[model samples]
Target: MITNMRKPTFIVKQSLKIFCLLTGFAVMTWSFSFTKYIRGQFVNLNVLPERLKEYMYFMGRRLNGAYLSSLNKADNHDIPIIFIITPTYYRLVQKAELTRMANTLRLVKQLHWIIVEDFEVINLKTQEFFQSTGVSFTYFAQSKRSETNNHHRGADQRNAALDWIMVNHNPSMPAVIYFADDDNAYSLEIFQQMRYTKKLSMWPVGLSGGRTYETPILKDGKVIKFLAWKAEKRKFPIDMAGFALNANVLWTYKPMRFSTDADPGMLETKLLERCCTWAEIEPLADNCTKILVWHTRTEKPKVRMFDNVLEV
Candidate 1:
């Protein structure tokens, strides 16, 4: 019985070896053909069918860690850094809104979040919350000019963030600047597109200016005009979330800062005019047809009920 079992085990081992050897030989043969094709050699293309080429490409991407190692890499000096400026104010759902935003921003590559709170001081609780989220961030406080003023109070905080950037980041460094509001919902694709902004990049914004979406009218990869509800009234009728700037633009055009003194709902236009003209705006998101960001607002949560029940 022992002799019979040994014979079967040995046969099985030999069979496995033969199978592996045949698979290796087939892969090597195909790899040689693929290499030749890659080098522009028009060899017998029948060796690599469409389906086999697709399979090998997919497997090659996986094995080479293209999708697995997107954020952290051994060498990424060529990648441009993205500076995201978020102006936040205390609210019933402030923490919840920030937590949701951070979850999305964490997936972005080469990002630095600059969150400026509209408060007199940066509270310890908020500091601890930002740290716990694990998103690389710089938290600071800049009090609103008036306690009761509701006319774009975030303008001051945004300017503060811009000042911080100007002082901290070098103008020679390759970087992109985006004003990402905490209440807005963002798609990671926008980050990818904005990373390559040479001067000014604009895309569509969903649910902006009392419309389904607002975008720049592109003609031959250039912005001809804006397709917004208030396009006629405002010089640059793009939403704050719809545009991004190359860091060098801000460095060179030092006057490009947000101001509450601008006409109502014209803060975006005010800052944009100092940076670029309509012709200079580069239309992104497939020529401004796709919306990669949305002006979403979270409802005020009823946390007062939790006051008498349990700590929330």
Candidate 2:
């Protein structure tokens, strides 16, 4: 009886020892792999105090903006830069939305992101987030003013971005400008199609206008008419996600802007009228048959209880 009891106890002890050893090995392996990742992020760091550098690196472990910095430094004069203008407002999902957009934009080369906030003053938290995104970006806030009932939402913010381009952008530099909404889904292929837009380029937008998609009907590689809900009513009936404009167009037509007083759904037409006509519109993405962009809107989060607890 005593021998039998001892044998069972010894087996239990051996099993426990094996389990602990396996657990410890896993933890050590994970630690080493994580350390390598952190060290890799700081490989290109050249000039900063050790303390500050450490703080910055640890604060944003995903420092992958090296590609944009290098591209900006390169003397590639022929590569047209795609300037993406995003007008954003404060909301529970704002950070999450921008983070998603940044991840996509980071993969794109020669892209400059211009984000305009609909706030009276610049938000520091947002600035830090943008810096960590690893994409070339310009950040600013919209001017404060009372809005009339007829003024379309986000018109001021979009106009502010265009204003920045007018004052700051070099017209001689080959570039294309796109009005990218924060909540939309964009494919890198769309960026490629619009990169060398001579005047104005357009493609199909998925899930827009309460339909599957909206696009400009093309005939012989030219935009003949829009295949949208109110195509016959407006000059440019497609959603904002469907088009890209040449940066030179904005510079050439200095006063062009989205009309604040334009009725709902008329903003696109107001701006496009100043830029190009139907005959001048260029079709892209296999002559407008491809759905490269989506007008996706995030469902509002129920954060009443969580709002005061922490930032979402």
TM-score of each: 0.72, 0.74
- Tens-place lDDT digits, model 2, residues 42-71: 233443455544443433322222211122
TM-score of 1: 0.72
**In every candidate, how many clashes are there?**
0, 1
* Backbone clashes counted, model 2: 1
Model 1 lDDT at residue 80:
87
Clashing pairs in model 2? 65-134
Scored by lDDT, the top model is 2
For candidate 2, the lDDT comes to: 0.77
Give the number of colliding residue pairs in candidate 1.
0
lDDT of 1 by residue, 41-112 (tens): 256444556555433332322111111102222134588889899898665466788888999987987788
Best by TM-score: 2
